[model samples]
Target: MTVNPLVLIAILLTTFTCRAERLFIGILEADSIQSIHYGAAAFSRISDLPLVQEQVQARLAQALLLPAYAGIAASETLKIVQSVDSDAPPAPDNPANVAIIPLTDDGTMIRQAFAAAYARHKSQDAFTLYEAPSDTNRAPCVAVAVADRHLFTSVSRPALTWAWQNRSKFLEAPAQSLPGTFRILVNPQRMADLTGARSAQAARIIDLGRLLRACEALSFSFTLEGAALAVTLRATAKQGSALDALLASWRVPSEPLWHAVPDNAFFMSLGAADRPDLWTPFLGAQRHRLLVPTSGRLPPPAVTGDRLDYVAPTRDGKGLCWVQLLPVKDPAAARAAIRMLADAGCTNAVTFSRLRRRQAGATAIETYTVTLQPPQMAQADKTPADPSLGHILLSLLLKRAVLECAVHNGHCVTVIGPEGAIDEHLPPETFAARPLPLNRRIGGQDPALTPDLSFGGFLCAADLVRHTVTIMPEIKPEQARLLPRGGDGATFGIVHNGRTLTASLRVQSNEIAALQRLNREGRAVLQEVFFQIFANQMMDSKRPAAQ
Candidate 1:
């Protein structure tokens, strides 16, 4: 029997898997990434695009190889392997990362390149090692083995030598390759152990180690198909991890909340929760400007419903607007819940005042606004207020902040936006109105698999960045220029089974190209924002505490 070449390649690629003991392994198909690079450039209409293969080869050579060595044909697949000792994590002194590249040619160019670049070399039966520059104390930074048809490189000489000895095992190991242009496999158990060995300071901010402990493994892949660039992320939970327990607690909705989404919405997230009360405090706190849910000051609102949140651009195109939709068992109870939440929000520090109440069709809509109250003092004692007070006053005068609520079509709608923007997001007369096309696709059926929790959405990356820059003019011109631009937007879907969660995102080719450029050149461009945030935190920490 004869097999097609594409089918044969797929079979071979699918059969390759990493060793069970390895902490992390990444296998990338060079051809696919190269194609994505070329596709992005073409989509962006760039006349001159650098050869990505040459760039890869140059980086691998580490400033040693001359430009001529870059002419060598690149390999089809590249493997990055990192393993950690179960008892002690790998550190800089005992580094355990190695890059394995199969040779398409005899690799004479690589040997010649190293010979021309370095003064010292050591020959071995298995591979030829090239010593680092004389100025550097490190030796045997790279290894080349033409006989074995592979090139191994690592910062640690022992790692490179070990990889050379174990090249056959790595080549023959079974790999679970995802369906994409690139693939990554991570053993989270090992990662969690590694994190435990590190300092515990990060846990105070966000316990990432705890999250990692709840996962068995993770896989990620990226594919450039037709005009779209798709990314797939999959994670498997440990047998009795926290994620497993949470997954068990969730009950899949019999009917998706597609009807709640508006057709014009650019972003929407719809999900079902068996315990609707768990979200009540969060929703209420999000509305109240002063009360923080995590601070344990605000009480949970008595809102009994499954929730969905969406953001839509205002009809006038001046700014963005948002709506929180809750389809509840009792609309009157939801109204009462909102009223209670508003009451809880009003305190000596801030004032939440009722602005208006009116009837629209069969629905009764109410509006409220929040503002900071002036400090308590005698009217005769006139004193200058803080400079920040002017900004608050300006915001109130602009009518850009508002909270409105209504009950329509068996749903309680909470609108948070500018003064007139609430009217635009009022619940329609019917729930089964036209939903976004992306929502229809995500809510559609696939008999192959069942999901406990599912979500779908789309984003116009260019438009979002533009709007952000417009709203916040403080963004530097250089930083704004580094942002993504000019794409047909992207769509994504996510589904979680009892033990696993999978998400896939697809973006236009132009957007993918812009992302690639950003990854390469935008890191330095965006560091200013992080610096400013850190500076602000430092200032806050240094401030004197209240008496």
Candidate 2:
């Protein structure tokens, strides 16, 4: 056959340019969180490892931090760290040492808050944000912003506990105070996702009312300007017997958004904890609920190793809590454990936590607690039985605070330990003969799998990064594409350089002999420790040199 009218007008202009590129298609903009700045510098090099500082002091000694403060992530994250203080030096350039409290009051969001605090420290000399300085040898300090005059409190900010700034390293930003300079308060307030309106329609009439009557959960504390604010409600269950059976079938005003539910007053569930005189403001009545190890290399603050989403109180356990400690560094021993637990009259408190897993001297911890009773079914708040894990306890308290800065700066010590503790010695662990097939295994290597953590495996709320994430992305589909799984046998694998990425995985799974297995083997040992620390931090990129 010899067809050629210029090949029939080039096959009808490539079949109408592939049907106008499949009718104006879109959705390919997946990459470019600018790789979240190389995933926040590979989570600041796995939170400055020493086996992630004994898994961020064994998850602040076993409170098992709520999953990555709800940013969401989990392919592998097993922590409980702390073991680095041969001395202690690295954090100065002060202003009451790194404090940023902005739930809102306004000023145009504190002048756009140093452009998101300079895109979250792109030049990290560690601390500094005085501003208006073209550059005067940086760190120039002095800052403060103590406000909470309870703007007529109805839902103020008390127990919110923001991201420990972003795990750790603020040194000086919310500044102000004096004849000198250090004023960093970029206030703009309101952050439980904006509030009010009968507390957002009574938390959407008990989670879109159903057969459920008052399926409850609520926490409402007080005090402001003098700080201390808390508000929580995770599930209301069928708002008023389903608004009295939809107003007897048509009564009007049911529009809490076509009954889609979930406005639980914006959000407070993320494991609400800290009531009866609520106090979580930048935590430092004598700090160190855990986060010490100083510059052994700086690792401790994934907020207990990533996976905390926020909002709890399903049937009782309520929500909200933040305690990232590292204390024990005499302040007369935490003011004598707060004046001997405040002369044994401590009031609202409960402790029995432990998350050390394998570090201090290697393998042996992960204890847990925070139990309180009541709420036979819901709405409990008389105070006590607080077991909230809202969003998997803020994603294991920010990945055990990014594994306590990767065990005081060595990074994951071949599996979590203070590895290069050198003459100070301690770090060690091998475990993992093979394990997985249960709920909470915080640090179990199958001695029949038991160290089992609890806040009840963070009340299995679900949404694990929208179904146990498997992205497998990478692009460049044009040239008139038709790509379908370019290659095969992919239980998992992906690539992309257009930036916009984030990977902090470590996943696990096993069941040998007869079958049932699918392991990522610590995502190939943290994707070769995140590409050898992203090619030595993009060849020490202060930027520019990559020709």
Candidate 3:
């Protein structure tokens, strides 16, 4: 056969061109997707749900233009593996349950899916893809044939390729850690760089650079062992001394105040370590005017230790009120300061009178009753008052209600609340003689989990669900329909472990199983319920000033 050299040359050139084009396009697409992921992660750190929603809506709009992309579909079951590594050995325990919906391999479909997953504000442009030269020395080389701003997909080609090539070793790789079900391994230095590139608007809202410097990595794991969810967080600092100083600043009392609260209390928060300076940030101009007058009267005795406990109405139909306990250095000084403020007319219509004294333990407790007059408003001032004003007014009223002070062991416990509620509702013995239910459940786990814990509380899930449904008639049917059966008796705790300042919701075994069994439809229903509750709470808490 006679062959033309020109024909052979043309064929060779065409093949080479196609291969080169694919590689160029792939690299561009990979970089674009990676950038988008980083941007999404940064937005999430801000904790602005509304802004996140806007972003999602914008992405969904773009996805709507793609014909191949359809709306999300329901799935019956979600598989949860320990790691993305294909050849890794099976976990010794039950795998964690996570909500995930995989996408098709088509470029267009993948891009649409990514958009759906990471909806961003309309103002934020979709990532632009452009061809770039590849570094031959880099392992797991990524290649592509075409670039599509709307159709390109795959968040990180390098990561995916690395995982595939080192399937068995990926989980144990030193570069990355995969110790938990929901793991986030962040390079602090890289995070700092990303934060620097963020918009001025975002930077002004949060100190992302400082935040990233405090934490090296975070992991969340749900295990059947003791039927609980555990969170492990790692902190990082440029120097060991800096890390130590950071932890020291957060140190709280060796013991928690929850033990002193009644078991029936519905909600409670106790701070073991007191830093009055921390409240300075929350003291806005209006609050400063109301609480801090020129008279130099000290603010409510620095609650060296404090407790705010609440209880819901009982079956017998008795409404419950919150009781706050503050330990001070000197009760007399605190009393004098309040009296001076009232005399200076800084307080709104306040009156104080002494009450009976009693003996408890090795201490003699003195009591006082304070009354506050309601704000006198003009008929035309019907416009809703500012939420900040309401809060200030409430604080003033509570300060004058009924206060009991008992000094022992170099500290004074100043209890404040309605006299009737305190006398009738508070148990004779404030401290628990035996281990509380939550303490029993937590067992011998590190005391560090509770000592410096900012907030720690436990509740019966079924009871909470029942009460919520009963109080909010509109959500009753939905709650009843969505809540899994047989998990009623399960208990859950919202704990903020002090050491790492990480929060987690720990659910019992039955509830965990129920959560795992939820199909896509069930999950959606639950999510809707959660969304509604969150929306309602946000609305209720909205400040007039913010509006």
Candidate 4:
């Protein structure tokens, strides 16, 4: 029997049309899981489209879950989502039929990008990947999905009038340069949207911070500047709109901050602001913390579901960043001390680069604890100092805006160190055999403060201009025993003075013997690497080897 088109519409409405988190299209084992494949009759008409098979499969990418997914368009082929089990349950919710979501905005462009990506996946055996913008009510998107720690992605963006690229490459020695500055902050969400409330009150404060800070920069009024977009958005992670909703439900205060949390909500009354009738939207919004830090280097364990929320700035001056919310508090010291309690269950308190300017005499380390929200913090560390606000913001902006890592060959290599620090200009390690002297200012300031630069699990003191090269090799399971086994298939390694090359190879047919032969040849290459590294170190003796 043929399936009705209305059935498709109902499925679409149930899974694709959701506003909170839409499930655009999906295929499932409608009747059972004893077998998994499409039924012959279910997918007959779809294959007639120019590229339906590829198009339907393209939408399967998980990274596309974000705003970048413009929705799927039907293409050349279709699948018959067939029953999977003989002993199938009477009613199975997972429909095996494929879906096609017509794109409205930038629809054509999205279709083209999808087709091209699918073609790449088929021809190159390249992993599909997507990185959708973290926006809602928007299309022309990108999406990413990772399985077994591997990735598949889909990408789309509106017509590029003149994007970040379009510059000249391969310039002749005498070529005149096009001198220009490119600074664009496109589609930055309101703090409320980006913060996505943990509660109405927290959401309000976060929104206020985002708005006020942006306003302070422009010296423009919110109304006149069109700064705040008032929407009844839920403050969930990503758009992180939960704090607003939670606060609205909790009936938290709306007055200027420093009002203590209500005795009812906060176990410890950290002074907050007064409540208001119109300010009801501030409750119930869940603040999205890096509830889990899944960083690649110091990534919290996949099991440790905690967002590697708190990230130490990438040690060795590489890419690193953290986000937090700061509210005005009573007995300012107590509020500041709030940042110190590791167990303090309040809004985000990590000393963001933006807060540095407001924190003049105060110092906040990026680590987990800083004595913020202290009942009497004004008196403690009355003279402590960290990089100034200007410095902090510049650093924050620099990391976000400047540093970017690109995968080279098989390894991921990224740039670090102060934005434009040159390796050639770094001074030699200032040595002292007896307890290296501390960094001292004009007064009695301790001089122990020092920063570092590193990459690909390597660290150094002086600027090293060379890229931190990484090598990745896919070894089949049986052949993986050749190289030291790593987590799953991942292994951590570095080249030593005697050893020069490192790799994680995959082998499907060969076993350990094949790998041993490969390793034997690698020794010569490793020797060559050591000689080159030794020469570079001799020329610039400041860089200690990365551990």
**Residue lDDT tens for model 4, 200-311:** 3555334444432221011000000011111111011112233232222232112211121111110111111122222334323333223211112221111111110112
- Each model's C-alpha lDDT? 0.54, 0.22, 0.38, 0.23
Give all candidate RMSDs, comma-separated: 9.0, 31.7, 16.7, 26.0
Q: Can you give the TM-score per candidate against the true fold?
A: 0.66, 0.17, 0.43, 0.19
TM-score of structure candidate 2: 0.17
User: Which of the two candidates, 1 or 2, achieves a greater lDDT against the reference?
Assistant: 1
lDDT tens digits by residue: candidate 2, 293-375 = 12122222312221112222222212122212221223232222322221222122222232333344432222223222221
Worst lDDT 10-window in candidate 2: 149-158
TM-score of 4: 0.19
Which lDDT tens digits does candidate 1 get at residues 1-547? 2222223233333333243233232333334324534544453343122454355434444422222334244534556665543334557624366766656567776677667656777887766667665435333355555435656666655555655556665555454445555555655655566666452555533456666777666667766344655677777767986666655544543244666566556666665555534433223222334322111221224333345777777777656666776666666676666565456554644555688887776677777775655444446766534434343433433345666777677667777667767677776656574443454554343211233345566676655545544343345776767665545567666677767777777666666556555546666644654455445545744689799
Candidate 3 Cα misplacement greater than 4 A, ranges? 1-179, 188-210, 216-232, 237-246, 250-258, 274-317, 337-419, 425-430, 436-440, 443-455, 459-503, 508-547
Comparing 3 with 4 on lDDT, the higher-scoring candidate is 3
Q: Count the backbone clashes (under 3 Å) in each candidate.
A: 4, 137, 9, 111
Return the top candidate by lDDT. Answer: 1
Better of 1 and 4 by lDDT: 1
Stronger candidate by TM-score (2 vs 4): 4
In model 3, state the lDDT of residue 385. Answer: 38
